[model samples]
Target: MSDAHVSLRDVTKVFPAANGGEGLHALGPVDLDLGKGEFFAVVGPSGCGKSTLLEVIAGLTPASAGTVEFEGWRVDADIPDGIGVVFQEDACFPWLSVEQNIAFGLRKTALAADAKQRRVRDVIDLMGLGDFAKSYPAQLSGGMRQRVCIARTLVTQPRLILLDEPFGALDQQTRLLMGDEVLRLWRQTGATVFLITHALDEATMLADRIAVMSARPGRLIDVVQTNWPRERDSRIVERAEFGAITARLWKTLREESLKTMALKGAGQAAEPA
Candidate 1:
């Protein structure tokens, strides 16, 4: 069997309108390959199709053309069990307690009750949600809610995890803390991750390689490899290489952001009153 964990071969997605008008072309004719157990990050300006790319990989949305393969099989339908997703929104069920929410997916599968319970408890403890396990979603802070969501996903032991702007709602300090937590979880699980974020610094800190995209109808502009040590501490960000990588990504994105803005302005000017 082929070893590529995730592969997008000239994939393209277009959204057809209800009125039979011209469709919106969202992505690809782009090629991407993610090796097994790699922490890959996709970074670009907002609306540059990064999230769309993630959705295609997760099988949440289908591509209009080309192929998406995960673990040597084509991803042609709804999300499969081997893939876990953590979206920006807190997706926990409101009525369930934190522990119940985390255990929800596991209970639906074929795992034994005892095994499910053990997995849920282990994730709750790992995520530091032991004290809040009995608390409802309404009782937790935003960061806490996100942690519960992540723990829920982790309990499934997925082969690939897709994170779409997972820390976008948190404050800077909390975002950093959550990033560290996510890194720890990935290391523990050894699952391949494909993260979508606009934060260049976050990408620089977490990614084994960062894929930078072009403006709308996004294409891969560059892929930057990060050679930093695997055991990253907070102080690692202070290193000269950290700033250098951040600067390189920023510079690439800056040009794309400008082009996107200019294209948007031109489109608005062309619209007839």
Candidate 2:
């Protein structure tokens, strides 16, 4: 982990109570080091602070305690320059075409117009969105629109990509296809990817290592190494090892998920009649 691209030391997040109740302990005391140019995924039960962990790592929300460092540099109030983030929600500008939307973030950079155009064009091709360059988000299918969102981030050439269920909204078939697209993009860009997902199959297929978390006060419960070859594609799932890996990931998460559900059920039962 000495050559880690992103390192977290005792990172934790606690949201203060809205009323006079105790603060919600969302995430924490996590110590993980994601290697440079590798794909890592996190899977856990619902309401297990998965998104909170991603926000803290991205510097979008401040951690209540501990520190996050990117390539030895401490992440502070602002998101570091070499990182890009994509969320589950569709963020594409409806009014803008695919190419225009991809170029949006580049406007804040000092790159020349021609350079910006080239960058956008390259990412469009990379994400296989060349056919829909002029199409707006509404004109594209769910998968294509997600590609646009990812392309928009890639156009900026970030060294680290943090994806929080980028394909969460798509159907299963489309989700697997999008996973192929992501694998291609990850190999091509050579950027480190940190993904947060709930799908065991997705995590098993895409990640070099999958981290499973505990219930509400989310902590890393287990880390399963996929040991997938770097040159692999989606077809690898056909292998028996894939099922074993997914089953292992689910095994670690199933207990935590039951815990989460029971806690919710109790909370509901305790509410005033």
RMSD of each: 1.5, 1.1
Tens digit of per-residue lDDT, candidate 2, span 34-148: 9989899999998999999999988899999999999999996568888899999999999999999999979778998998899898888888888899988998888888888
Off by over 4 Å in 2: none
lDDT of 1 by residue, 196-256 (tens): 9999999999999999998989889899999867677556688899999999999999999
- TM-scores of the models, in the given order? 0.96, 0.97
How high is the CA lDDT of each candidate model?
Answer: 0.90, 0.92
Candidate 2 to truth, TM: 0.97
The TM-score leader among the candidates is 2
